[model samples]
Target: MITTIISQTANVRDVQVETIGDRTTIFRSRTWDRLKFEIEYAQQKGTTANSYLIQSDKVALIDPPGESFTKIFLEKLQQHFNLASLDYVIVGHINANRMATLSKILEIAPHIQVIASKPAIKSLKEVFGQYTSQFHTPNHDLDLGQGHRLQFISIPTPRWPDGLATYDNATSILYTDKFFGTHVCSDTLWDEDWKKLDHDRRYYFNCLHSNQTKQVETILEKFSTFKSKYYAPNHGPVIRYSLSRLIYDYRQWCQAQQTKTFSVALFYASAYGSTTILTNAIAQGLEAQGVHPLLINCELATPEEITQVMENVDGFLIGSPTLAGHAPVQIQTALGIILNTATKNKLAGVFGSYGWSGEALDLIEGKLRDANYRFGCNTFRVCFSPKEEDLVKAQQLGSDFAQNLQKSKKNRPLTLPTNNINNLSSDRTEKALNHIIGSLCVVSFKQGEMDKAILTKNISQASFIPPGIMIALTQEQKTELLPEIGTSFVVNILKEGRNLRRYFSPSSINTINSFNELETKRATNDCLIFDQALAYLECTVEQITELGNKWLIYAMVNHGELLANTGITAII
Candidate 1:
């Protein structure tokens, strides 16, 4: 009976090539299981590889799914129109995986012209033998015949340097390949349930866009010039109702990263995609420490841009995959730029993967050493393939790098004031760990229409992209302020003081006056927040795990604002 139900749900007909608007059809490939292409999709739930067909007088297909769906995709595509009639295939980007499907498409439709950005065209010619004849790099408006006029825009990011999008004049639908997309599969074709997808959408941005905020801000600016009523992304749903909200949110997320007090720039290039994986783990580590690392793809970044980033960041890390006993040309160029551009006082770290000789890693380490730059950690290296443990270590390296950068900024050292000697020794470990676990903040919530707050130094940041934190709550705290998944709350970081801490002590929590007694204001999420705090993060609970004696809660941060620009986080 279970098998029968599963089979019924996996019906191919559930999501087929269907008309969504005038002259536009969506060839959505739905998967109930994981899409194992990239790290973002690999660990998460299922996703859709959305392909679109525009049936203008000159027919064009936009952003086909990867080779995984080649046979079935070809089969269904032939049912509607003749393969020979498909004139142009507008490819948003080129990857080895997607090239396989493009190969199959060429095998069936030999004369189909491929349209892409200049970078993508170069890749297409290099990958596909026959692509030289029909490849086109559109630098201006592209007429698809009749009313379906189109324009191509290049919005290159670190992860996808060849990213491109198309805008249809008649329908006002922007065919976005990677922009404004989420990694989730659905039977529906439209983004009608935009609220539930908020978390996933934010998570997707964190994974892909957070590090490339500079490029993303440029993309958003490009988007504003377009008169698009909806966005047809290559994953999840067609963004209609949520288009405006998402655009604004993307800007806000980018602004948050841009305005950070201490920033680290992470530069990387992966030969076989191994170093890329390590780079992501390291980025997660930085995020866990509440620092947003600026990611730069050496392959895509110009020398001037690289130099500018190195000059602005407080610290920077460089990672490169070895090729023929040396670093890739891009990395070598970046190394030269780094040596010339960055001051020796900044923190430096190097990491990468290699087949045999790791001279590339050695060269970077040696160069920085000669410059007298301080090393946060040893050079991280992975040979042939990286295991689970390597990723964990890479993440630790990132976390350590962030911690070191933060420590370097502090003018004063942390010294404990004299307390009861017996009590200090009893809980020294937990107390010491608490200081560095997360920010020292008072978490506030509303229970039964009354505002409540708790002094928590254990709210550890868990995910950076989706903006989330993990918190362990005592039984008393749990009962005082209920925390179920999806509930909204605010975590307010405190300024350096002793008065607020005394008010939220275990003995004083029960006897405190009304929340109104404190100088507070309402958050954007409608939760109470202390006006004098360093900053506040608006969060919605995502998961709950029960430990032996404590309840662990993971919540996604929706929005955050710095209340006092000069106020530092309280380290009580």
Candidate 2:
């Protein structure tokens, strides 16, 4: 049978094939260009789409990448393996982003059995229709000749309900599709430099898994039964050297989420997806205020789920899209459940979007009011698609709800200790750390006789006892000009540095007496201080830790002072 070539190309860099283990080959599609569409790729470190193949008598390919890498990935894959001999395509998780790749795979090799959990099969059928007739829902371990036995674990989370994990009994290699993965691309395959990948891994987990704490924790427990030597994830490097460390980190991260001081159970039903967008904006705001929302789509949720989440959470936010001038029946049902089963004293908020009418918001708010539930913010109504400012307002409304909860007696603060920070335990601490807006400053640097100044906004308070601050520098930075241990420098916090930023950015640092370009003076530490700075800190470098391609400089604040009375610092 002649196979038609069909795949989507992306802004990709290259695709490489390598054999990792016995009968296991990996096709890594790498892109040096950062993804702009997804919030998860905000770091701009670029990414890799990792697809693994295991062959014995039977062959299996696991977790094909999205359309971004689909074209080149398939080409590279065909050059390595005989598609006609392929027996199974094990889908760990299925999403629209990967539909193109899976479709082309089936089109080329029609006899291939697609193995996944029930939900994943459903999703595949929904996307490919009758073509998914070859899909298999694994109920038992599949054995290939020569001891290549595969056990499938259904590790479903709210975000990815079809999340699955595959374990090879013979090789002791576990394939965790999205779990324990980072977005950074590298020349090396194994996590030999896991210390450097810490931030990226934590960032990935925060963006994807933080909100799915209960499910993640339970999955961790389920995975504890398996004895795996190596973890082959869907992104970045494979976990061999840092396998135990990452699993422990996941456990700590999950514990932190469960220990959060406040929780928001968000119930939303959207028609035409307009209300969903508004809900996302609101959730973003809540996250900004350090309150993560447990999102539940009312249409997909069950009555028991509604009761469990509503009864236990510190607060609840309800949103709906008006259908025939009334709330969706699911929304109505959820509202009824909350009104009857939920306590009136619980913090409550409501929002809705409508093209014809917004009576749904009014109905939710009225019912909630009659039930005597305390309102966190006024009901937010949208006529149709929300504007930029409207989204901002929605965010502010979410912030208001979280801020109000902070004042309530039911909520308590969980401060993440700065010192001896080995692992995560306090959820607020992680959230608070991420949310702490740093004041942009032009920091002084010294190497030998050369003096330099560079504008940066990555400064964060690291310790309270010594009043220390941490600054991150890219690994490609001019190390000869960097502040080494015992090197003293001045942090000139910007007052109104928008226009003045040109003096210190794009081409900042390296110039001898760069401060001469601006009005400056010497601090007590003998470092140059900008005259226009809002505040100045004289710091001495104490510790330098390497994180992947970045150098994190931790320094003690020897002396500091506020020069201006104005509290305003950010200049965008």
Candidate 3:
């Protein structure tokens, strides 16, 4: 993957160009030195804003990188071809952040047509204001000459309503903007080091797609008509070799998120992206407890959508940012919807950020309290933007709220299906399955400052080449560390220790940190390796699939050592 440098300056941007296909070149405006404001951008993985240039009898540039790369991106573009040669400047989505870059493009290529989805066109008009007439909304496929016909698909998600994807019929390449994208930057043109990229890709998926699974699934189905050889996404490595595998992975991941039993409707209105950061942290906390979080940016979410989510969820969380000492109009509208549609028995939570007075937080807190809603935790409020400590606190509060909800439902009757079927065969199958036992193990993991462990009897080898193993456990409130794909953990194979299982079993009080009482050593992955265990395998979660109330986590073994060679493996 040799990069052809077109232009570079000391303090300015460095534009690297790589030709991926016959007539397609990727102009990647990489911001390796500076970090963006978004939560995903701060990941420190080195981000790239990929812009593709297609040359045929006509020319088109798809998706100019955001405002940060405005000057240098245009400078690099000037080095290769005349601005007049660029026929179309196609945008996958529209937002205020990219206005500067788009404005620069319009200035340089005044005669060039701008192509986008109908919804995106509206945003373009709003952003461009007086220059709205320069835009062209696409209702049908456009031919760019030399047998290169372009097709646009309007695949909108709640967070990004103006979302669109482009396909080049000539090269059979799908330019999936934001779909199947990670924030990591590298010189590798394809996903050849997929094993190393698993963590970053899964993290990106969880941040964006966890709440948008339904829309993502629909888009996947809609894209099935196209025979795409490569998925040239907006960021990360282009999918040249692992296209089919990535698509299947996305489907499985989204299905698992959507199929969770307990769900939370998280409504928030972010000002300057602060509230969104807090929202993501809290969502991560809920997901760690096996509670599916339905994130809704109130600014984009409709009243009907809010009502539907509140009705289906077991609990709800509301967060907002204060502007002019009041909650945003969108937050107010969401509050009204919640008051009307939500029941008194459902658990509720409130959190927000404010620059000056926290009147908005008090307003939301009072409204929920007056409506006889039970508070899952204390109302959390932070000043201005949340710091690292604040985000961590928010996450911990969310985790505590989820655990409280589960505790309240401890003695509640299991809601079984009403459809009458073969009861005898089901009972026989259950008994037969339980009779087959395996080695009892304690799975422990550490992410950031938090450490957690779980007791499990279901463990088996999933692969031999990678030396992998699969561990399956039921979703529980006390379980703070759900084995998400890309996380690292250690499997401590117990040595005929029945008491160890009891210690790790579910209790009224969470004792996940009970390992402090035992002799443990930290593995290279930073997971607590039990000293008394028969053996331990340091592994990274490779994939996660859901089965009923349990999550089947598959991990690739990275390191292992035998602690007690003569000890027999503990059986369930």
Candidate 4:
């Protein structure tokens, strides 16, 4: 299933496209929530880009997003089909300015060619070298074998390098380069709420307004004659059902150069200068990274500040200091209000400081996780005083948070690997193995066999033997060691003959004899014996080896199995 995991509050949908035959698959990005956008400065929860996997006779991918998105894209592709078999990756205009990270794609499918316009090729080379090769984009038809052909038309756009639109002849789908598109908080790819579209279009226009007119005109002119069944823009939804209407609207809007302005609110809290330090640092970072982080302090910041910031800001950040064990009551209350009141398009993050235990960070993280807030890492405590190391960590946190926020501004999903059992540690491996064995035992025992009999039989029948009979300590060595409850009897057996053991107690001899007999019987059953008394099992040989003149034998069970489960059962 092509599942869409969106940012908590973002409206920018990410498309995860899978196809059977000429089918277009789209995966939407996850949404971001209040705490993410307002406080943490890393408000955007997940910043994975979107790519459309078009499966015709020749598979084509459109505008593979960022590194994270590409990872997910390739993984999903591998899950469905062989990545090495993929034919072409068409670089759409929308992702021209963004770093495509083609290295990742090449890693999966080295032979696959990345098709883009001349300018896009330059940008791709400049941004990602050695991963992609140059491909021509002419106002001509390029045929992919089996009648699946695409017409590439390049139009220089203000925001991107030589934005190009592709027309799939088979599907009559017009891959728009940002010509007939709008910025809207939409779940559905095509034909969103006009009002929301207007708001987002305004945002896009204001951001792209400087050179948008020329780009829009060029795009409209290039495809003026072509009859399109579907309008797939790089940013927004693909206008499948109503192509002409959306195009007409976009044309009129572009001609008018209409711009809309909105506001954003940034709320934050700080102590010992960590959060406060990072808050400003993040804002500066965002500005540096092409996102505007509105800085606000909840102690003095107003609702109007929040509203104003929210109006224009696509993302927000929240920062705080852990008070007692949770976020400050004021920040929590503000978050509650934002959650109840804010419209979609807002992304948030949680940041804070603590003294020792990360209780507050955990609480905030819980809140974010529970509320489905798409957020970055938690702001955590530094021991007592604010040190240079703490500040540096805080700055790094701010930078990462801002990057995620910037990513959300584009409405990308965060694509991360799903951890499997192979990544577990030795202890966890042991536990898992034991569980599997236990489950097998349970299943086996259900067939009318007693648990004790089965377990004991299995244990006794293993080939590995214990240390008791294998090691023979000298008289001087035995005298130097402290004797435990069972050791004295075993020692006596080592010094005296198996039949002549009256030097110790009669009970001790009987115990040793019983142990020996049981071990022998177990060894005979399966050629393996489990000696539970050994500190470490050796597998060098069946006979004991003398280390430092002390005879030491390899601990083995009769059936060649190692004894890992020790000290759990009685020999009798």
> What's the lDDT for all of these models?
0.76, 0.75, 0.75, 0.46
- Residue 33 Cα positional deviation in candidate 2, in Å, after optimal superposition: 2.6
lDDT of 2 by residue, 154-207 (tens): 998656667889999888899988898898876677888899999999988876
- The total number of steric clashes, by the backbone 3 Å criterion, in model 4 comes to 85
RMSD (Å) per prediction: 24.4, 25.7, 24.7, 24.8
Clashing pairs in 2: 196-547, 196-548
- Per-residue lDDT over 443-505 for candidate 3, one digit per residue giving the tens place of the 0 to 100 score: 787746777777776776565454577777666521456536778878787766435666675
For candidate 2, what is the TM-score?
0.63
Candidate 3: how large is its RMSD? 24.7
Best by TM-score: 1
How much does candidate 1 score in TM-score? 0.68
TM-score of each: 0.68, 0.63, 0.66, 0.40
lDDT of 1 by residue, 1-572 (tens): 00111222563422356677788888877666765645467445677788888988889999888877777777777777787788989989888778888898898889999998887888889878656989988867878887888888888877788899999998999988888888886666688989998899888887777778888999999999988898998888889898899998999989987887778888999887788878887887787687888889888887668867876777889998888877876786577556544665578999999999898898778767755579877899999768777888998999999999889878734524323422443232222211222357777887767667777776765654445778888766665665577788887767665356555753224223634566778887777878777667888888888788888888887776655523224654
> Sort by TM-score, best first: what order?
1, 3, 2, 4
* Candidate 4 segments exceeding 4 Å error: 1-21, 29-49, 94-100, 127-139, 182-187, 192-196, 258-572
